[model samples]
Target: MTTPATIPTAGDEKLPQAAKQSGQALQTAGRHTTQEILTFTIGKEAYGLDLLTVREIRAWTDVTPLPNTPPFVRGVINLRGAVVPIFDLRVRLGADATEPTNANVVIVVEIGDQLCGLLVDTVSDILALSDDAMQPVPATAADADHNFLSALATHEDRMVALIDVARLFNRGVPQVSEAA
Candidate 1:
């Protein structure tokens, strides 16, 4: 909500180099280890996640509704034979529901032993950010949105909020039981 993420234009040679380098806070020689972040948008605002957690990125598709769940729970989609639940990132951030369209995308991510997809407006840049580049979320941001953001960092004059995967589902994904 602070600022919309700045996306790199095509033909920018720097992007490839940034994308190639990434990690999950790992240590490295000389400089701090880089964390590769996958950036995406929800409306105009941009958000990012540690690339190590991402499973894949797929086009938006209709999902089968579940009986009882939160409004943010868009429903479940079939990924191969596996049923993956999709969450509306907008709603999760306490914003309006996203009107699904062909342009939308599902970012499949794995947290611990669980797997799920995050529905967003579109996918953008993969940034290679060093540890020192990241700053803790400001204490002034005491709102519904603050709980979800782990840190904030700038990439090309744009601010990208690093989402904490552990807090996305409060550390536990819904348990889907088998139907006899």
Candidate 2:
């Protein structure tokens, strides 16, 4: 394997004497030694998300369906007086609409500036993984659903697809236009 190029840092001798000592030139170099993930199930598949992004996990609640939105958009719920859109994780991941039951749950997460809830079959467990345990999604996975998976991690004989919440919301899709 080829050695990666070394980025110049504030401590590098090549920098001007005064510039080398400036803290602005310090290279931001730190790896997450350990990360916590919130694991959930949709269908038979298990998935995970950065625990830091998850605000709360609530039992499944009936939502007020909105007209003219995508099928995957399950509609909004009253979250402490704030209307938060709830996305069906199954449908968003290209599966059929989930038939929510008492066991189902809604994972409230803050994606960007918006707070939305993801409907999942069940909240499984909290997983703690080291940085090295995360593997990049294969380049061959070019499907819409797979694109939302940022990484894969194995937990006790099962592989969990690590969902990228940001990408999950930002995927490019054809826009619906109103016709006169």
Candidate 3:
């Protein structure tokens, strides 16, 4: 797996001067202003979210069924010590639901103070995108059953829908029962 580079900190006056120069160079190169996005796939389509909102990625696992909940909600999972609700992205995207396969993954994301898992087909790499590369979602795209998409990003000859995590869970999520 490719890992992000760690920035070295300044602990002395000389280091601070070098760090300031490097920071200015980065800013001049437009690196500090560009937003990084983490992309993933569901079926054949690509989607993205702000890299800052992504908590972690995990392999698909068995989720405990919740009773009297919407069909789109798969169930809840015990993540570490917390109970996290998992949503099936296929169902939420108006696609027919299917069983999880070896390639499936769960993308844990933070929406405000709430954490939830999004079950997707695969996890792709993080990408850096400039503000000019993003465009408003077309009317047809905005009319989808899913209301979380805020914009569409075109990068590296591919299209990625930008999801708004906060808007997705602005309303209280329905409680999932252990028995479904």
lDDT (Cα atoms) of all candidates against the true structure: 0.79, 0.77, 0.76
Residue clash pairs of candidate 2? none
Worst 10 residues of 2 by lDDT: 22-31
Q: List, residue by residue over 1-180, the lDDT tens digit for candidate 1.
A: 599888544344233343335324544566356788999988888899998899999999999977678888898887877788898988888899989999999999986676788999999989998877788887775645457688898887889999987687773246653220
Candidate 1 pairs with clashing backbones: none
Colliding residue pairs in candidate 3: 66-177, 67-177
lDDT of 3 by residue, 6-62 (tens): 764444323323226423111214323356788999888999888878899999999
**Clash totals in order:** 0, 0, 2
lDDT tens string, model 2, 1-180? 999999655445354332243221222225234567899989899999988788899998999887778788887888877678889989887879998889999999977766788999989998887656778887775564468787899877999999878788785322322220
Rank all candidate structures by their TM-score, best first, as comma-separated numbers: 1, 3, 2
State TM-scores per candidate.
Answer: 0.80, 0.75, 0.76
Candidate scoring better on TM-score of 2 and 3: 3
- Which window of 10 residues has the lowest lDDT sum in candidate 3? 22-31
* Candidate with best TM-score: 1
Q: What C-alpha lDDT, on a 0 to 100 scale, does residue 162 get in candidate 3?
A: 89
User: Could you list the CA RMSD of all candidates, in the order they appear?
Assistant: 11.7, 10.2, 8.3
